[model samples]
Target: MTNRADLHTLTGAYATDSLDDAERAQFEEHIGQCPACAQEVRELSATAARLGLAAAVVPRPALKEQVLRSIATVRQEAPRTEPGPPGGTVPRAPLRRASRWALAACLAAATAFGATAVWQHREAGDARDQAREVQQRTEELASLLAAPDARTRTAKLAGGARATVVVSEGRDRAAFLATGMAEPPRGKVYQLWFNDKGTMRSAGLMDPERTTSALVMKGRVGEATGMGVTVEPAGGSPEPTTKPVALLDFPA
Candidate 1:
């Protein structure tokens, strides 16, 4: 039941595969008939793929040739024959056949090594992308906090936990921070909402397993008057299904 506007805001997350299964399904259904959202998702997905590729290390053109050459040049040692009864030796497999087997084994090993190298490089690239994303979010959060019009409000929640919201209308963004938050009951999560007049809009969600920290909400602040948090089934509800644990009003 996510509003159409909030559903549209999920294109980026869907492109990055960041949405939980439920949210992903919801977005998928939304995009089936919405050409605009479908197009945006496609573009964002392509951009994300390009970013991943940008971080990948390209191997030298000659590297494959060198590996093949090395495999081709490998000398196969003769198999040792076991001693047999009465001054005779057990017959060994044909040298040609043994050599072919050895070559095949070498080729297989080389192929496996190549695959491992590629996998490692991709993993390194993913790590770099994650680091860059973290840095970018950190910078954004810092700017939001330092905005001249920034105002912060804190409210106590259940179990003595507290929520602190830093909002900067001038920047059209807000950040949510929490401390002493205990994990929600099994199968439930904390969902954030933007109070637009009396109509609440889905802000985003807090994963039950992750540490609740500074979160820059998913979309523009617009003229939202306040923010609130409610417990919802895992993956969140389109609207708040429970009483808000905490609510904070923006500074006038």
Candidate 2:
């Protein structure tokens, strides 16, 4: 039988259902006389249940067999003490202390597992969102390419470079391809522009290292009357900073 002081230490194991039959019976008898031990046991049991629910997972087919085999090989601790004639027996203080520490470790493992599961779930959701975004972009680009009225126009640049523009009939979408463009002077990049009437807007920057590159222009392509490319500072300017190396004008 576990004494009143030792009963408190077994509360954690009792709550987690880890205590052996004898230890459990002894703890229950002690708790009946100790209000504080009873309350603590109840609280710990509730906490363990919550942790169990959060960490619940389907076990593999062989898990049950593995667990049973493991239990069979393990040696069970002897009863702390035999009950006296009328009163309870003295508890093995060391064993009771070890049981409490063991229960704490088990709870910690469950908590950690629960936290890891939550993080992985969030990561999976983010990956799905990214995949959906890429798919949508792919579909939009495909639709633009399949448009019946889609047409391509090519322009020769000063340095034997070539610029090709593909525009849909509605002029709502466009793609630009550049090839053989000589590397820009140091501290400069090739910048694309869309001219709507007289208003110039930046499209995007070209890759300096690539001899061939392509860009799918965003926004309303129909609003632009013409397109041009110029060499500008590395990051590109808000407006054209140099004469265009090549330009393509759309039919009215």
Candidate 3:
């Protein structure tokens, strides 16, 4: 028998959906018999619920459009400035100083905004380039994930709508990297599973954004029965929920 206090400790992880298979089973066994543990889980879960509610109900503060309008006001003001009455003779010294200040302000704004835009452009370009590299390299190394000599593979998924997988292979084990996958719907996940015969074996549940990497926990020849990929509900189905998108059945 396990202590109820120990079981209470698992409550946080259980509520967060972070526990692994064996831990889940152990937690379940403890919670089922201990009403105290169940109540504690409920109380802890309620605390978490409050945290989520606090986050969601946070007032947007109505600041976004206001800030944008503030920015625009400055942009428009750049073109309009207080000047001497048109018919009056203006002092040349003050005019020169004003002109110099205006020119300096324009240059300062240009430098700041220009640098920002350039930086944004460079960052986006780098992301695209990285995505491309991940795809290309994953494609190349995917074939070797199960090969004894293979090293590593990685892929970046885009949106929950599309998919990408990268596998890095080595003699004893492989790393299956998942990236760019959108957050799963509330209770679902894109799971990692292995196929053995007609039966599907669980590898692990995917990460929230699908930027998850699941290391193959066990070693198996890539050429065995067949290697497959599937998308399943969040916690992961006892079995695959849909047809596979890839199969590592070589020499076909």
Candidate 4:
């Protein structure tokens, strides 16, 4: 049919067996070749089937009596009239009402499905981005570790802990490793900073839960005079909040 929207609207009625014989035959033929319509019909049918199963509860004896009493109190409404030939049978209004309700329910189900699908797609994209970041970091760390000119310097902290920093001046990169240092106080984190000449800049933050860990520092090591670690508030700070616990000068 040229009117795809009209044909598509028949899906819910067909799934619920609420369509007339002529309408049902037309949709059946259309669904056979229309993959999108076929898939929509399948999902709607499954949702309808689940609702049917859930509605199969045995009613209490009092429920039937209560319903009958409620029906007795309600006034019977007359159906709307439409133009038709004399002696012709008019379409049942209750059937039309049932089909409308069924279509509305199916539309709601389709909307919910669409929202969930969009959320899942976004979640998958975020996961892929995170994976890519991790892979890049791993490769950078490996390259720094394998550099032939890499040299290490060590500094002893106040609490007898040690911080070792590896650098490759040729590659303009560095990696920091800490050991035997107690975790920072609650609401605080350990952050790494690099000093280039007299200018100080943040490198990265250490994992708070980790007592011993290594991280490949960010930023070019151009004219870097030293590396230092400081305790700062959780999530780290733009500037060092306190003096370094350990500072190691790079070899000239």
Question: For this target, which candidate reaches the highest lDDT against the unseen true structure?
Answer: 4
TM-score, every prediction: 0.49, 0.44, 0.31, 0.47
The sequence of per-residue lDDT tens digits that candidate 3 reaches over residues 68-147 is 77786665535564666778644544543343333323322221221233233357788577556544433333223323
Per residue, candidate 1 scores C-alpha lDDT tens digits across 110-182 of 3123223444346778857755665555556545554546667767777977677778877899877775677
TM match of model 3 to true structure: 0.31
Candidate 2 vs. true structure, TM-score: 0.44
Looking at candidate 3, what is the lDDT of residue 246? 46
lDDT of 2 by residue, 1-252 (tens): 664566667777777777899998888888898776676566555435433322233445665686689798989998676445456445545544455445544553432332233333367788577546544543454344434466667677777767767678574877676666788888899888888887778888876755555445766686788888889999999999888887898534
* Predictions: Cα RMSD each: 24.5, 25.5, 26.5, 23.1
lDDT of model 3, residue 228: 55
**Quick one: best TM-score, which candidate?**
1
Q: List the residue pairs that clash in candidate 2.
A: none
Q: Which digits, one per residue and each the tens of the lDDT, describe model 4 over residues 177-226?
A: 66668899998999988987756789998878666655578788877889
lDDT of each candidate versus the true structure? 0.64, 0.64, 0.45, 0.65
Candidate 4's TM-score: 0.47
Report how far off residue 177 is in candidate 1 (Å). 1.0
Model 3 alpha-carbon drift over 4 Å, by segment: 1-148, 151-172, 212-214, 217-226, 245-252
Which scores greater on TM-score, model 2 or model 4?
4
- Cα error of candidate 2 at position 47, Å: 64
